[model samples]
Each structure stands twice: as structure tokens, then as C-alpha cells.
Target: MGKKQRRMEVFDARARYYPSAKLTLEELSYWIAFSRVMGIGPVRFQLLLDHFQEDVASAWHAPSYELTRIGLDQRTVDSFISQRANIDPAHELKRLDRLRIQVITWKDACYPPLLRKIDYAPPVLYACGQLTEDDLHYSIGIVGTRKMSSYGRQVTEHFTKELVKGKITIVSGLALGVDTVAHNTALDNGGRTIAVLACGLDTIYPPSNYHLAKHIVDSGQGVLLSSFPLGIKPEAGNFPARNHIISGLSLGILVTEAPPKSGALITANSALVQGREVYAVPSSIFSNSGAGVNKLIRDGAHPVTEVSDILEHLNIHTVPLPDTSVLREPENEEERLVLALLSREPRHIDDLIRDTELAPNIVTSTLTILELDGLVKQVGSMQYVRCT
Candidate 1:
């Protein structure tokens, strides 16, 4: 079948399984806006839908106590109904459409089936990029601690680049530490990455990653997504709500480094609950950052010592994906530093940080780009061996 046909088939299947909306832009805008209401998680919201029976707008319009019966806490039901009138409050859909971001509802064919299967799937996703046929098949989630170690940072960067080289959609939360490294590494390597946010796409949470978030939207090749709407600041609770979507969209999640009780651990937990495989980069028992991963491994999560570990676990033959490291030409001083230290020989990242005088993430990122271009090969956990 043609790619479009295949994508449509996927969506059509979802439409069959999910509650139908008006399917109008206005209806979609309503769901998009309502998703922003604080305290309305996917499960509670789905319970309300059961009471209303596929009529989100009608259910949204129902009395506050009506939702309380369906599981929305009294306070949230009040807030949600109060917020319903503005569901498309800012004409954001027009702006989104103008910018080429596609909006996919739970009923849409393009929504990830794994994500849709989650108990509290967003009523509609305000997507900033297209989910093509190939996307349906080759999606992976790479996430972990925001304060990642140099080792965690490098493995996350390397494996994501390898996946991107294979034309996979890299999914992440766009948080500062590892998510930023993962998204940025994917981009630098000429690979597209999706950033799932805890807040609305209209605003960036960390603010530092704003430019990176913009880069994804501007590429028209990937998405910046959220269940929340415009004007909402990110809150702590909204974050785990955000984690589900990240794990929901992928075949599995890779925990590069996560301390006990870390948010990345929350994502890993979500992956487990969602029936997706979870992988961890085993860290030294001495480091606090590695504690969660060690615990996860002890609890039976697979350990990812190499890229092949993930690829093999997913059963994807990684040999065919295009090499983008060549197509991704580096610019200016940063590029110069990276190119200078990178050689065909296998080099540990510590030696590169010393030799190139670059931050570990930067050197790791640069090597990722070169590797994606088919220019470097990572031979060991710490080594970057240039491909040519």
C-alpha cells in the first residue's frame, strides 16, 4: 500500500476503536484546549468519557458533579468545565495549521496506537509535525535524568544517533538534562526528534530549551506536543502526565541515567505499566545517578551496555538506515573543535574532552553527528571510533 494509505489505515483503525469527536477543526480545538486544564489526567478524563459515551464536548459541558461521578475530583471538574468554553480559546489551531503542525485526536489514524492504548490518552494531540507511515513503524523513546553524568550523556547521545541514522523518530520530554542532550544530538546528527512537553507547545518550560523546541517545530519534520493548552505554566504534576506520552509513543524507553525517584524513573515506570520494554544503561554502583538504573536492572529491566542491545531487543535490523553524519555539515568554532579531536581511531570521550577542550556533551554531540553521517563508530561504552 501507498504510505498515505497506510497512515490513513492506521488512523481509521483508531477511529474505529476510539470515541468519535465532531472531527471538525472546532471540535479538535476544543479538545486541545480542554487538555490544558490542570488536574485532569488521562484516566479520570477517560472515566468521564465513559459516562458521556464519546461526547467530550457534551461531557465537558455537563455539570461539575457529573464529572465527579466519572472520577474527576470535585476541584478539577469545576476547573475543567469552567475552561471548556475556551477550548480553542486563542484560535491556536489556525496558527498551528499555518505553521504546518498537524493536530491528531485520539480518534485520528495517525495517533500512535501504543499511545492511544494508554488509559488516559489525550483527547487530541496538538502535533507540530507529520506522523508519516514510516513513523508508525520506527519510533523509539530516549529519556533519563536531567542531570546526567558524562557517561550517561554519551550513551544516550550515541544510541539515539544510531537510531536516527536508521530513520527512527526519537521521542523525549525536552527537559534540560538528558532529554535536551538526546533531542539536540538527534538534530545535530541530521536526525529528527520529537519533544513531548509537560506544558503547552506554545510555551517552553525550562526556557533554555526554547530554541531547541523551536528548531523541531520549524523543521516541519518533528513535533513539540502537549495535552495542555496555551498560557499554562508547567507544574510538577503535569510532568508525570507528560511522561506517559513520551513512553506511550515509542516501542520502548531507554533510561540512560536516573537516580531513585527521578522523573526519568517515572517515565520508565510508565513504560512498564504501558507494556513497553524498558532498557537502562547500567551505571557504576558508586554514582547516585546510576542508582535508579541499577535498581531497575535488579528488578529485571534489560541493561543497555551498547546500541546493539537496544536494536536487538527491539528486533530492528539497524543496518539499512541512512547515514546522516555526512549530510550534517558542522559550522563555526564548535564544529572546528569537534572535527579536530575526532579521528578514525577509537577514542574515549574523556580523552576527547581533554584533547578538544570541549564540554563532554558538546564533544559527545559532535561525535554523534559525525557518527550519524557514517563518519564515526562507537566501539565501546566510552569509545568513539570514526567510521572513515
Candidate 2:
């Protein structure tokens, strides 16, 4: 099939599954076209709909002066009028069929219900994975900083593992540090994870996680998700919007570690605005990594001292860790020493070296093998933590 035809197939699939709006073929196109225009966000789009009574194509053709009467700014009203003739809503409608990617609009019943309550929910969302009502009803939002302390890493892994045991789908921006830790840890625990991106699904930010994204989708254990169309690139400002989406779809938000001004903090704030629960894992007051979490706790966010701290808050059962089993084979002498140094919290590598009485190179070598086998994870060059 041609790209256009495939795109239509996706739209058809979504139309079949969607449960809202008596959208005719024309209505979906008008809604999608409005969402694509710059300077016309969800709020302004609503004004247009209110006046046109959801006759989107008619709204698009309404006089510019009439739009202004409804209080659209002069520039935006003019912009809309000027773009109407050139913007091809039909092309986008056709492209959805061409790409073979499913499209779910506000009219669709399969649209994530939690997300609909957000302030600026997208008019249309594209899906690559199978998203059922069950997954939507059981998502847990996990977020953290791109640079993490050993303690932060441990907390994220521990909480994510517990969420997995509760049959919850983990959601996070696929950033480095805590986000990566959350997704991988959930997968490690035999659970599914969903990655919300700041860019299009066609583009992977922090390219290192590309393999992990593939791994999630390939395993039937998780999915890759995004709101941007196929061609958009990640801009710095896209992250805050991404944060809203993360908190929007989830039942709650957990901050494993972050600086006070970090994007994770923004997510917590958005969660609050969205009426979702916010949880934080306290870190050392001395470490900058823990400063955001500490502040969150001070501001009345719940504290998570252990996995159960969060599970208990959500009224979930925490699964006990398996008794330490013998490794299929030891990776190296350092594996023995590094393993000895590990506990529930991640320790700095220097701390590990001092405690293990091993050479740095040997310790590093062993940690690498342990990481590959999913038995251990390196939180820092000098520190390692067993997968929580």
C-alpha cells in the first residue's frame, strides 16, 4: 500500500475503536487541522468550536472579523484566516492512512481518559502499540532527573519494580538517568512500560535508549508513545509539555531524584494541578541530587523510604525479592567484591572500592558484566548498585 493508504488504515482503526463524538469523516479532519496550526492551541480551538458549533470546516471558513468578535487576537485570527486556504486538512487525513500508524482523536472512546482531563489535551494522538482500557486504568507515572545520584537510582528501581508487581504499567519520559532506570527496571521485573517522548515517535532522544525502546515494543511487554507528529524534532521547550503528558496519563507521579529546578519538579506540579497523587523518595540533604525530593517532601509530598512506602500509599502489595541465587557463572573477581558492596541503596564507586578492597579496573570489569546480565547497574563510574 502507498503511504497515504496506510495512513488511512490507521485512521480507520481508530475510528472503529473511538467512543466519543459523532464525528463524520469531515469532522476528524477539521479537528486535526486546527490542532496542527501554530498560535491556535486547545483553548482558542474551543472558542472556534463554540461559535461554529463544532462545524469545524465552517469555522475554518468563518470571516476573520467574526472570529475577532469572539475575542481571538488580531494576529491569531488573521493567521488562521490566511492559513485556511493553504493548509490541506485532507492531506493529513490521507497521511494517517499512509503511515500505517493509528490515529485517536478527541472523538475516540479509546482516547486515554485521564489525559482528557488535562488542561491542553492533544486533539489527536498516534499510537503504535495496543492500548486497552485495562492499561489506561492501571498506569503509574515515574519521573526523575537525567543525572542521578546512586541513591536516586536505587529508589527509582525499587519503586518501579514494586509498581510492576502490582500489575501497573509504568510511564516515563524516555530521558537518561532516572527515566531510563524506571523503564528498564520495570521490564526487568517482567512488566510493561510506556515511554512518553518529547519528540515524535520516529525520533528517539538520548539516542542511547534506542535499543531499549525497541526492546520494549519487541517483547510485547511495553510500548513507545508520543504526541508529536512523525516529523517534529525535540526542542528544549518540548520537555515541559512532555512532563504534563507523563503526569496526565498516570494515576500518580513519583520523583526518585532531581534538583529543585528540574523537569521532574515540573511534573510533580502538573500532577498536583491534574489532581493526581505525588510521591517522593528522600535523598541525602548534602547531595544536590536529593534537593528536589527533599523539597517535595517539605511541601507535603509523601515520603518513600522503601518500595512498600509507595505501595502502601497506593494500597498495593509489595512483592518480596527472591532469595539471592547463585549466578550462572561469575563474571569476574570484581563481581564478588562489587556484589559484596551492594545493599538496598546505591553506593558511590569510591565507597565500593574502599569497602571491597579491589583494584578499580577489576571492579569496573566485573560491574560491566553484571550490568549486561541485569544483575547489577552502574549508577556512577565509581559506584554500582544491584538491580533493585
Candidate 3:
């Protein structure tokens, strides 16, 4: 299909999903205009809304004195006035429409629920793909060092795959290393992911991930989310704010791997401040890549050894459909013993060994048999669960 046709379809889909009654298109244009002003952020934006009785168009046209009366400093008022003169609100909205981007304001019912609870959540979001209900509710933020070790890569893949199996959506920054692995694993497993960008959706930073970003949107399984306005470039200062959104959208933040100085720690910290759970993989004490996660665990972050650690703590219960074509009863006591220990919650092999008191070989062999009979499934590294 032609690019224009695809854009038209996306626009139509957005209209269907986000029909606005409280904020008309004209009012939204003013919101977009204010978002573009340099000095106005969520707090100031809210002040304007409250002072103007939620009429953003009125706020936009308010004189400098009125802006000052609403508590905007003289510098901010000057910036707003200077920018507002050059910014045509209608043209800004038209530009977004032309770019196939959808504007999600704080007033929209379709705004992410978790994000709305944050202290200073963005007043506006520019999204490039569909944001589903699943993305809003069942999301886990995966972040780690950009320079990942081989161990980091393996750990990220394992947790991501298991989370996807549990029907959880992955949220990440779309940076290299752990974020990339989490996004790709979720997609490969036929699950959804959300890529939160520091820059505007118009520009995919790190440029290398551009194709990955395209695939995410084109596959219809994920979204490209950003709070920055159109034409904004990726800046170093933008990342800390970007990290906040990643954690805000997720039920918890998981640090699969990271060094002590990794930016991923910033995200974990944000998760804590947001009153969200923080999960970290325990790595070797001697490994430099493990220092941040180890510190997190020491500071009371949940240490994840298996997928069940997250699922159980978060109270997320996922039951995969049984493979009807291969249903069979356990033919032996060993198979029955292993099957008895397995439930919808993933159990590590070591835990089963201790509980079953069976020989390691016996437990392994019995699990193999049960899996072949479609009675049990492995959700992660050496973690098994009942099929039903």
C-alpha cells in the first residue's frame, strides 16, 4: 500500500480509539501550541488550565499580565509570548496530522493510566502507533547497560521471553543492549512492546534502531511513544525525563543487567519514586556488569531468579491454552510427581528438586516426559509450569 494510504488508515484507527468530547480539535490545538513553548511543562500547563477553567485556547491568548497573574515568571511569560506569536496552533496540529502522529492530552481518556498517576506526567504525548489497553495495564520496563556483557544479553532474553509468555507487554527506551533485546524478544514471541523515545517520534535516536522502530509500528504489535514535541532532537538532557516515562508506564522496572554507573539505574530509581516495584537480576559479585543490580537488591529491590518471582509478587496470573493435540496422562509415578509440583506459576528446577526429593536425573527426565505429553511447559531457564 502507498504511504499516504497507510497514514490515512492509521489516522482513522486513532479516531476510532480516541474520540474526544472534553477537548475539541480547536482546544487541542492550543494545548499543542503551549507544549511547544520552551518554558511551559506539566505543572505550569496545569496552572494555566486551572486558571483558565480548562479552556487552553483562552490561556494561549491570555496577555502577559494574565500569565503573570497565574504565577508564570516574567521570563516564562516572555518566552510564551515570543513563541506563541510565531506558532500557529492550527498549523501545529496539521503538521502532526500530516506526520501521522496522534496527540494524547492529559484530558483524554485514552492516556495511559499508570502514567497519569505520576507526579508530573507529561501534559501531552505524541504517539506514532496504537496504544492498546494491554500496553496501559500489563507492562514491565526492561533496562540495562548500553554496553551489555554476554551474560546481560542472555539474562535479558530469558526474562523477556518469560514475561511475554505471561502476556505482559515490554516497555523500553529502544536503546541498544538490554532494551533492544527486550523489545525484539517480545516481538519474536508474538507479544507487544512499547518504545519510549527521548526525542520526538519524527526522529528515532541512535539512528541504528530506526528499522527496529519501523518494525515495531508496522507489525501493529507495539507503539513509539514520546513526550517531546515534533521536531525535537534527542538531547542528553532529555533522557532522565524519558526514563521517568518508561517506568511510569510499567507496573515495575526490571534491571536485567547493568554496571554501577549505568543509566538503567536511573530508571530503577524512578520506579521507586513512582512507588512501582523494582526487580533486579542477581549477578556474580565479581562481575562489574552486576554491580548496579546487586546494589539495588541490597537496597531492597526484588531479586529475580525466575519469572515466577515477578509474576507472583505482582500477582499476575497467566494461563496458556493447553495443546489439545498432544494431551496425554502421566504414565509413571515420576511424571506424576513432577506434574503435581507444577502449577500456573513457574517453578525453578532447583525448587522442584528440593520439593520432590527426586534425584536430579529423575526430575529432569520426568519433566521431559510431561512436556512431551503437553502436561507441562518451561516458562524460562529451568522454570516449568503446568500447561493449563
Candidate 4:
């Protein structure tokens, strides 16, 4: 039999198994099947959708000739044909359900709004945990070198804590070093975070962070997301592509610390290409670990020193400070010194001490008094911000 005839025969045989009664599920199954096909990415899948009038089931059943005519190369058409013949779309959906993986397609209402605006956004996302509207809207990608230095660790933790205070959901690759620190800090601070994996949801890459991934899902703090179909391994080549999704899902990308050759830079580049803001921490010239972010700053990425820099650049309005006039006036010189040094921007106790030229004992006591008086609020750790 001819290729078209064979395709028809396969379709006919599976007609009864198709979830035709549930049009949405049926269409989604076809989309999942296409996602499993090699060589068919977001751009090609979109072409099929357009040619088939947004009917993914029709696209899946389209003859080899029709697929080729619609711009799929012969190689891709052959891959699709071979894959579709063996892939029972309904069975694929069942597998996802069994694994508790939620699939978000382009047509789904819960699809990330920021991600949808990117060029060649993934046609489907496999999520292993809940994705809230807050996660989709208030996320920032915090990525850096896997072999992070002490400075990198400190910077990542500091920024993560401050951003979490602003109610920003952190997004990271879930790699070691900076990515790990970003996720942990966000979680520790009781903020939601999302981990974008290069592999399928079935296997968490770097196996060591499995517990971390579990914590993210189990705590209901965030989600573990991927574009790759189940059974896909985390190959070296998958990461660069994965970086695109990281940037795509975020309102902006932040490079806390990265070497010149770090993959974090790739994500930053993707952010710039996607028209998303790219922020980098200023790094020392002597430090190799800081080269990538320093270059990023030189290339016009926003050099961020504080959380407000990011929030302001994104035009995100944080919670308005309470009016200080209602609060009791400062009772001592130490109280006035500390209050004068604090603002809506968070300031660490050490910085407050150094800036105010006060004793550590005095600064700590003044901050305690201010907290009690509602004149200053401790955002997290020892960081304090003015009530007004």
C-alpha cells in the first residue's frame, strides 16, 4: 500500500480508540503525539496548526505529501509518519495522566502568558506540579555558573531573598551552585519558585536534587516544568534549548554570577532576543566567575545592585509602605539614626551599622525598637525596610 493509504489504514484502525467525544482531549492527544516526533519543533508544529486550521488531529492525520507541501521537509515528514503510526495519541495522554503530569498546550487557558509571547514558544509544556497565575506572572529567571564561587553564592542568596520579599517567583535550571541556591533561598523565604528541566518530568536530572524537586512540588511552593516529552534524557545538547524556555517563561533573566562560557549567558542572550529584560550583577574584573555577567552589563544588560532595580525596570509596583506619621516618633538618637538610613529599599543590619557609624549593639537594639514601633519592617533575615 502507498504511504497515504497506510496512514489512512492506521487512522481507521485507531478511530474507535480516539477520544472523539471529547474534542479537547482528542486534539490534545494529537499535540502530544506530535511533540514526541523527532525534528518537529515549535515552528514546524505551528505551521501544521495553521495549515490544518488549528486542528492538530487533522495535522496528525495529514498525508506525507500534504505535510511536505506545508513546509515539513521529507526527513521530518518521514519521522512524523513513522512516529505517528506507533504512537497511540490516547495512550500517550493516559501515560501522562498516570504520571500525574499536566500538559499545557498553546490553546490552553492556563498556558503561561509571558511564554506565549516568545517566538517559537513550545507547543506543549509538561508540568509535574501546580502552576499558579502568580507563578506565571511574577517570575524572574535566576541563573548562573554551576561552579559558583563564594561571592556568587552570597550574591544569589542575597538577591533571591530580596526578590522573594517582593513576592517574585524565582525560576532556575535546578543545576548545582547558583541555580540550587536560588531555588533553596526562594523556598526558604516562603516564596514560590519554578524549575525548568532539560529532561522529561519522569526523571529529574542531576539526581542529587531529586529531594529539592520533591520539596518544590510537595510543598506546593512551585512547579517542575519541561518541554520535552516523557522518557527524554538530559543530553548535553538539551540544555541550550532549555535555556530558551527558562527565558521564555520569565519576565526577565538575572545572571547573578557566570563565567564567560557559562550556559547562564546563553539564557541571558535568549532573554535579549525575546525582548525580555536581562539583568546582571556587577562583578569584579579579577574574578573569572564574574566575567559573563560583567560582559553582559557591558553589552547593555541592566546592572542590578538591589531588588528595586529589577522591580522598577519591570514596572512592578511592590506593596506600598505604611504611613510613618501614624507610628510613634523615634525615641532616641540611635532610633533616628537607623530610621534615617532605612527606606523602601531593604538594608542589611551590617550596612545600617556601617552607614550610621553606630555600634553593632546600638544598631541591633535600634532596629528591634523600630520593628516594635512599626517604623521599620524586617523583610527577611536581618534586612530591614522603612514602613513609609
Candidate 5:
């Protein structure tokens, strides 16, 4: 049998196993399947949804004449009609479930509200890790060339560290160079980060960043996100599409360094088109890699000399102040108990555990949090004291 006929057989088989007649998952499967169709992209997908009263399953079965009448070109309609038979929504759902990936449709409550506001918002998001309320904070995008200069590297790290410290969630493409620096810096500083990928969640592109991707997932402080279907390869063309999601997720895009006509410049332009703020770091006028930054500054992109430049431009106040005076309050009974046990004079862990009648692990964990908050200090092995 030909590929087209084989697809038809698969679809017929999958239809028998479609989960009941419910409108949620079954409906979602149609959307996922439609996204996998060769010629249907964001705009056409929306057209299909609207033409079918938001019922993607019904839209999937819509006749080619109806699809063309609803605005898809004849070629696109023909492609969808043929490919719809080949796609198996059930198999897609099963694969995603087995891999533990979460598919967030536009209708899902946890979909990033800021990203949904864009005109070209993705209808679905494929995430390898969790998305939480904390991720919705004022987010920033950091982009630059894969080949970065020393100056570019320093600026990316400095600004990303400060932004993460201020509780701003960092968003990036998970590409090499500036994006890698941004995500790693955020994780290192105990801040949230989100990486938008140009490929599918099941495959990590650049191959070398598998460990980095794993760290993002395991950290629980960040997520790896994509709109591509399972097993999609990272093609050169996919990146421009990826750029839109990066800019859409962020409140602003920062171009740390780029030469003229770079992909980072494309993201900055997309941010402007999306009405998000764009910031660029100024570099030496003589540097070829700095050319894009200079032009962006000339064209009215905010020139960032410090992290405060971004804060001031965004009108964000109440940044988390890190100091001895600003230590966080004890979060639970265990933390309070640990703090109560500490004195100006160092006390051994064994003494605290015995005096408070707390378990060793609890005491150790509490002391670690207290030390991180700067409310306590370790003067020696297993010996801790309250910091004045």
C-alpha cells in the first residue's frame, strides 16, 4: 500500500479506539493531530477551529469543499484532507502519555497568559516539565548568536543573574550561546527559567545539551517547552517559528550581542512587532559582532548598561532585596524550631536534634534553609550559629 493508504488504515484503526465521545481529550487529540498535518499551521488551525464551532474533531472530518470555503486554499485543503486520514490522534496521545509530556492547549488554564495575547499564539504547547503560577511572573527573553564573544558572554551572564535574582523568569530558545547562559544562570541562582525549543520534546537538538535539558527538567525551577510534534527535527526554518514563542512568552527580549542579519535580531524584531519591550547591550563600536546592538539602540531599542535599565523601562519595583536585613521569614514549624535552637554561640547539630527532639534529617534540612536565608551560619562541621 502507498503511504497515503497506510495513513488511511491507521486513522480508521485509531478511530475505533478514540476515547469515548467526550469533548476534552478526544477534542484535544484532533487538535494535536491537525497540527501534525503537513500544510496546516497556526493561522489555518484557528480557521478550522472557528469554522467548526471550536470542535476540532468535527473540523477534522470537515469536507474539503467546506474547508476551502472557510478560507484554506485549495492546496492546503487538499493536503489537510489527505493527511487527516494518515494521522492517528490516538497514537499521538498514547505516545505523549507514555513519555510523561503535558500538552497545554490554548484553552488550558495554565497556558502562559502573556503568550496567548500574541496574534500568532501557538494553539498548543508541549512541555517536558511542569508549569506553575510562579512562571507567569514578568519574564524576559535573552537571545544572541551561537558563536558569542567574551564581552557578549559576560553581559549575558551579568544581566541574567541580576534578572533572575529579581524574581523575573528567564525565557530563551535553549540554543547555544546566550540562551544556554541565561538558563544555566537562572538555575544556578535558584530562579525560574523556561526554554522554548525549535524541535520536539522527545528529541534534544544540538545533542550536547542533553545534560542541560535534563537539569532544567530535574531542577523543578524551570521547564522545557515546544510546539513541535513528537520526533520533529530541528531544521533551520523551525527556529524562526521558535523565535515567536520566545518573544511571546517574555515581557521583553534582550539582545546581548549579534552581528547584522542574525537570528537574535529576528527575535528582537518579533518582540517589537508583538509590542514587547526590546533591550540591547551596547558594545564597542569597532566590533563586528556588536553591529546589531548599535543599530538596535539607534532604532530606539532600550540600551541596557545595568539590570536597573530593564527594571526602570518595565516600571518594575519591589525587587527582592538580598541582604541580612531582608531574610525571609521561617516558612514552617521545623524552620522556626531550628532557628530557635541556634544561638550566638555555635551549637552542634547533635545538640539541636536532642534538645528539640527533632530528627537528624529535619534538623539538617531546616539548618540548610536557614543558612541559605542568611539567618544562620555554619561555623564548623555540624556546628551552626544564628547570624547577628
Candidate 6:
């Protein structure tokens, strides 16, 4: 028998055994196969599912005429036919099993409920770590420029720590800069996080974050998520599609810092379209990095200066804190000097050196000591600021 005939036969045999909401192994394989198709995205895939009576396996093996009738153009139908002819659903599942990547269909109970409410919610997600009930309860999508300023870093870390303390699950695109800081700060605070990737779960895009990805998976504190199947590379076009999932999965989106027309802006727009709240941290008007954020604030995004702003907007009560709001007295002359030089605004090491007339080594060591004592935080590039 032909491969299409074989697929139909298998579908027929399992037709009586199909569950109401969950995908069978064979069904999941077809879902994975559908994810690999270029022209068939969330909306087209949904059309196929509905046309096939929600049997994705049957839809996967649907003939060209049926696909064209379901609104796929000739070119797209041709591509889908050619791609389907080459992929093996069973072998794809085996590859996923080998990589330890887990697949969840839209019908799965564990799928993000908020994501399901979106118009083009991903039909399937490939994840590298555990996704639990709590992750869905309260999630904040944090996004910003890959070229983050020290001030952006400081703000991201501060708010991320506070969110974790409030038991909010942090979500981000797993890009560089703000995304990395958000994930690390959440993990550091012993809270859960979820990283939605622009590529497949098998490949960590940006490569530098491979160790961080592994830590998230192995530590069970976060999940690495993607809508693409295995072996998909992080192409430029993939990220705009990826941004939808980030916003779709979150309760709201926080744009820490972005330049005009940045990818983070795309995510914020997506959040607004999805009816999720968009929050922006107001930044110095002089900084280019803050331009997008300031515009967002002007556009009526909730302006957040502190974590309480976010918590208040979300109506989540903060956990009680110990009484340690006051800054500690400096232990020595060097510590006193470092404290005197630092302020709420982030200052780079070179600036400290220029102002203090102290050796760079002394400045660096003092900043490190101050950071360890929770009196200071290193934002990036040897920049330091007082921890509020």
C-alpha cells in the first residue's frame, strides 16, 4: 500500500480508540509533522483540523484537493504536499524522544489557557523542561533590547527579584540581555521561569545560553519552550512569529527597555492585541534605549517604577518582607567611598574611577563587596548601582 493509504489505515484502526481531547502518539506525530510545514501555521492548521473533524492525523494525510478547498493557495498546497511527502511522523517522534523534548498539543490540559484564547495560538509546543500548573496561574512576559543598558539591567533584575518573591512566573523570549537577566534572577530567587524560544527546543539560539538552558531544564525551575519542531534554525523571520507565543502565554508583558522599532515592541504590540496588559519602565529621556519605553508610556502602557506597580495592577498581594529597608552603615573607608559614589542611577566602573580618582582594581573590589552585601548591584559591564 502507498504511504497515504498506510496512514489512513492506521488512522482507521485507531479511530475507535481516539481520546476526546488528548492526541494519541500517532496523532502527536502528525502534529509535529504539521509544525514542520512552512505554509501551514496556527490558523491554517486549525482549519485543517476542523475540516478533518479534529483528527490531525487524517488532516495530515489529506489530499491536495482537500487542502486547496480549505483555503490553501496552490503554491502553499504544493509546498505542504511536497513537505508532507518527505517527512516521517514516526521517525520525528523518535528523534524528539532521543532529544528528550516533550510535545503538547493545543488540546492538552496542561497547555497555557491564556494562549488558547489568542486567535492564532500555536497548535503544538515542544518543551525541554517541566511546565506545571503554577506556571499558568501567574506569568509576566518580560522583554527588552538585546543591547540593554546598565540601567535596564538593574531595573530588570530588581523587578524580576520582586516578582519572584511574589510567586510570579517570569516568561521571556530567551534572547540576550534582559531575557537572560530575568531568567537568572528568577532562578536565583528560587522561583519558576519559562523561556519561549524562537527556534526548536533541540537548538539553543545565541549558543551562549546553552548552559543556562541546561540549568533551567535540569534544575526544574523553568521550561524551555518553542513552537517549531526539532532541527529548525533560528531564522530572522521566526522571531516575529515567536513573539506571539510569548505574549499569548503571559498575563501581561513588561517592556524593560527598547529602542524604537525593536523586537520587544513587537511583543508589546502583540500583548495589546491579545488584550493583555502592557507595562513599560520609564527610562531617562536622553538614552536611546529608553526611547521605546517612554513612547510606550506615552501610548498609555502602564508605567511601572517599582514591582508594587505591577503587583497592584495584577491585584496580587505582596508577601510580607523583613524589616531591612534601611541601608547598612559602611564597614570601612573603602566601603564608604563606594557607597558615596553610587546612586540610584547606574554608573560604570570607568566613571567611578574618574570621579573617585581611585585605582580601577580598588573600585572593582569595592563594588564586588558591596554587591555581596546586597547594598549594591552590578547591572552589566562593571556598572554598579545602589539596590533599592
Among these predictions, the greatest lDDT belongs to 3
Model 1 Cα shift for residue 213 (angstroms): 0.9
Give the number of the best model, judged by TM-score. 6
**Alpha-carbon runs more than 4 Å astray in model 2:** 1-21, 315-342, 345-388
lDDT of 4 by residue, 1-388 (tens): 0111100001111112222233477778888888898888888888887899888888888899998997888988998788888889999889777767778887777789999999989888888677777887889999999997656876798789878878889999999889999999999999889999988787777777888888888777888889998878888898988999999999999999999999999999999999999999998899999999999999999999878888888889853221223667788888888889888667889999899999999898888888877678776678888864
RMSD of every candidate to native, in Å, equals 9.9, 6.1, 8.0, 9.6, 12.0, 7.4
TM-score of 3: 0.80
Tens-digit lDDT track for model 3 on 29-139? 898898888889989999998999998899999999989987999999998899899999999888888777888988888899999999999999988778888888889
| Candidates 4 and 6 compared by lDDT, better number | 4
Q: Write down the lDDT of every candidate, Cα atoms only.
A: 0.72, 0.75, 0.85, 0.83, 0.80, 0.82
Error of 1 at 293 (Å): 1.7
User: Could you give candidate 2's per-residue lDDT for residues 117-151 as a string of tens digits?
Assistant: 88898777765555766467778889988988667
Off by over 4 Å in 4: 1-23, 318-388
Query: Please, what are the lDDT tens digits per residue for candidate 5 over residues 1-388?
Result: 0111100001111112222333477777887787687778778888877888788888888888888788889988877777878889989988777766778777777779989999878887888777666576578899987878766776787788888878888999888888898889899988888999888777776666777777887767788789898877788888888999999998899999988888999999999999999999998899889898899999999998888888887888866633224557788999888888777556889999998899999888888888888688776667777854
Off by over 4 Å in 6: 1-21, 69-72, 318-341, 347-368, 380-383
Query: Model 1's lDDT to the true fold?
Result: 0.72
In model 4, pairs of residues that clash are: none
Preferred candidate (lDDT higher): 3 or 4:
3
Candidate 3 Cα misplacement greater than 4 A, ranges: 1-17, 318-388
lDDT of 5: 0.80
Off by over 4 Å in 5: 1-23, 321-388
Worst 10 residues of 1 by lDDT: 5-14
| Ranked by lDDT, top first | 3, 4, 6, 5, 2, 1
